[model samples]
Target: MSESSIAIPTVYGLRSSGNCYKVQLLLDLLDRPYHWVDTDSSAGATRTPEFLALNPNGKVPLLVLDDERRLAESNAILCYLAEGSSYLPADDWDRARTLQWLFFEQYSHEPYIAVARFVRRWLPEGHERQAEIPRLLERGGNALDVMEDHLGSECYFSGGAFGVADIALYAYTHCAADGGFDLSRWPRVGAWLERVRAQPRFSPMAA
Candidate 1:
């Protein structure tokens, strides 16, 4: 924790989740102090009464302020934590552009890439869900291709600097191969990953 984060909020999240890791990454990038409470939505953890009270949606990456104010949704948390920081764009148009990419990540990217990783990591190979892997990979690859094209032109999703959009997309895109999506084909996207990793105080996803 940095001196800047001395009295910030508590973060309840699963260490392995990309959604949760995005918040963790932003907090680290901003040098914001936060208490990370390990909370797994899998293994029936998020469904528990205590966890449900925090987020009725029964999800991880929930943020609770010192005053007991709670906020859910991973991207929303990123926006909150990055406000007034370099991670968030000061101009209105650039900020909205950042949001545009964030929305693309959740809808067009994570649904395929992240879900494929979850199934592959947690489910048995012979399980019925394994049948979906091919389609997931196909969709995930398409999302990656889009990223490759965009990243080929702009150094970062924020246009000039690293910001929340880059973090949001980077979460799953970096671990894409875990879902069986071959990343070697997208050189531009791969380079962007390295750029984001090179940022100061950047932290890896917890093991």
Candidate 2:
């Protein structure tokens, strides 16, 4: 399709969500212009009939093209927007390797880190979910240790350069301390976070 024939996409997301912020970060980094619809899942926005029509699974970070086609999942949207950009690896094994880390972020990293952040930072104190904090911190720290070991040997995750994997892991890992995990214990991961921030067009997560 011609460039003009393609529709600009709209993102439906909560500004504070790391998953949502992942898409926002990449779109800004690529200099791709798009619309943002601030939808908070915590406020029952995702469960609305209109949003359910767009994504039956009812999640934020949903991307809707002007043509009405929709895409879901933060990492999937990252890969789509980053196609042909330096944020995505071009080499065969490198791209697969990037996917590996992306999967690791979702399965190992985000589950622990993101959840703890949500419960600790977003929820009121004494909320029932605060009980999960201990387990979350333990697993989240394990994930960070893995990253620390890998980063001690190399600069970025996956392709020896900045890419989607970095974006994926960087989202929650950088804010892990808010979840009660001490970043000082993982110096390599700390340095990697700084490296990601130094990349051109980087933006901090919404406060």
Candidate 3:
């Protein structure tokens, strides 16, 4: 199909969400055209009946194809959009490595780091969630340590190349200070972030 005939995908997501920013970062890096529909998940927009009909999980960062088929989950959307691109490895072992890091980002990294950021940045001062920050910081620091160890030997997260897994982790890792993380503790990871930033067409997450 001609490029002009291809239908642009529409993304429904909150600009400030790390998960949503992952999708946007990958799209911009690939120079792919997409329409972004701002759906503020924090504002209860994702909970509306109309939004629920689109995704039963009631999450932002939903991807709607031209035919209206929808995809939920940030990493899933990344893998889908990265198919056949260098961003997704073609070699089985390399692709498996990429998937491994993607899993790690969601399971081992994001829950601690991203949630910490949310509680600290978005929650009202003295909100009960404030109580969770100490634990969150400790656990999130562990995740950063893991990334630091990995980066000590490797340059990128996706099987030795900058790819979707890097995008996945970078989404939250860059802004971890909002969660009270001291990036200086993870020097290699900090350097890796600079490399990710140097990639062509890189775009910073919205404020």
Candidate 4:
């Protein structure tokens, strides 16, 4: 809410989530400056009366524009903020390919891997949910294998260049090890993580 006349967006969410971090990653890369209002996604801060008013879903990674346009969903936020930019591909087929990987990340990847990370890291170690760890490890590994095969042939997840696809994929992939998904088995993916880290204006998700 600064009066500088820079009507950029301000993001709100926890730093650890791939969904939240994806928007941050893009903002940093674009050299866009804005405010950050940290929400305790773990403690149900998103579900509080105030935050839920911003997004009925009570989700993290909500984007509040200078004009007060509130947007939700990490992938959709990335798309909205990256319009007319290189983060989105100019070609029709390439754009579709980017969306393809994003869809995979949410349905095929996040449900298995990110949820595992959340349960393992955020939840208490002795929580009843610990019983689900074994399944998450197995399914998460399978998802990583799929990512490995795809990344072996391309620099980024889409268009062979860094874009929204990379932003979506990198958010979780970089933190997969927290849930016991080892990168050693996927050498190419490991390399891809390094590449993401080396992006010109890259910022750590937890930064």
Candidate 5:
């Protein structure tokens, strides 16, 4: 591609989605410029042929480079965007640690927490998914406990710094209450949320 043909990166995302919000949060924290094409997966935006062509997974928060390269998965996108930045550590072990938490957020944390929020807030009352909330809360609360325990000694998730891992965890954690989680139950995690909010250029997720 010609140098002049390259433009700022474009992110296809849903503003209210924690996964998508993670990308927006990091871009803002880095003060990086990009285009945002709002894609609401809940509204079937991602399932369309065009979006599917971009990401076969049919997920939002897909990053399209100015050169037309596409990347998917929120955590992977964070690592790619944060490369060589403070958000992604230069040290091998630190980077591994960051990846560890990133994996945790996806496997142990987001599945229960984000889904609970979706079931409770997005799905209408009496929906079949509502029955899952109680179990979801149980599992999600365990994730919160793990975070609280981790925060008891460490201030941040990304190798002792405010970085992409924090942003990843924070995206869903701050709004965890919307999933019927009582943040008060995890005091350390609650305090960590405040610390994350205090970071420079920190942007609030859409309501």
Candidate 6:
């Protein structure tokens, strides 16, 4: 089909969670307009057969691109949209570093920092998941420590310039206190967060 005949892109996500916020932030940052579909996974919106067809994992932050093409995994969506932009590193090794931190953000950081924030902010009062808060706090702290060490040497997560690496990690890192992880201790990280915020067209994650 011709490009003009394609449907516009649309993104589906819950309000909370850095995973979802990453996509929203990138879309806002780039001015690559799209429709936003508010999906509440906790309310079973993600489990429906229709949503599963879009993403079998049943996770939020799924993107349906122009012409009905679908992309899942927020990082993948970021890369797809960022292909020709400054947000994507051009040098092979430098680009790899961005991917490395993006992976770390998902594997090591998101479970602790993002999950903890979800439990604290999204879960109802007196929820049993509160029992895991301490573990979440510890893991989140460790992630922040790694981030602090890295940011001490580089202005951005991947290196000198702000790229997908910064956006991928910054989504949750900025709101780490919601997960009970303190930012006061990580001065470098705090500075990095400020840098990301200062970028032209920088967008805050939806409330």
TM-score top scorer = 3
As for TM-score, the candidate ahead, 4 or 6, is 4
Candidate 6 residue runs with Cα over 4 Å from true position: 1-7
Name every residue pair that clashes in candidate 1: 5-33
lDDT of 4: 0.85
Report the lDDT tens digits of candidate 3 across residue range 16-92. Answer: 99999999999999999999999987789999999999999999799988877899999999998888889999999
Structure candidate 5, residue pairs in collision: none
C-alpha lDDT of all candidate models, in order: 0.89, 0.89, 0.93, 0.85, 0.92, 0.85
Q: Return the TM-score for candidate 5, rounded to 2 decimals.
A: 0.96
* TM-score versus the correct structure, for each prediction: 0.95, 0.96, 0.96, 0.93, 0.96, 0.92
lDDT of 6: 0.85
* Per-residue accuracy of model 2 over 34-109 as CA lDDT, tens digit each: 8999998988999999999999999989998877778999999998888877889999989998999999999999
lDDT of 6 by residue, 32-114 (tens): 67788999988999999999999999988888866677789989888887777788888898889999999999899989998
Mind giving the per-residue lDDT tens digits that candidate 5 earns over 5-26? 3257899999999999999999
The parts of candidate 2 lying over 4 Å away from their true place are 1-7
Model 1, 1-207: lDDT tens digits are 233443678999998999999999998887878899998777888999999998999998899887677899999989888887888899988998999899999999999999999899988879999999999999999999898898877999974679999999999999988888888999999999999999999999987
How high a TM-score does candidate 1 get?
Answer: 0.95
Task: For model 3, name the residue pairs that clash.
Answer: none
> Who wins the lDDT comparison?
3
What is candidate 3's CA lDDT for residue 187?
A: 91
Clashes of each: 1, 0, 0, 0, 0, 0
Relative to the true structure, candidate 4 has a C-alpha RMSD (angstroms) of 2.7
Which candidate do you rate higher for lDDT, 2 or 3? 3
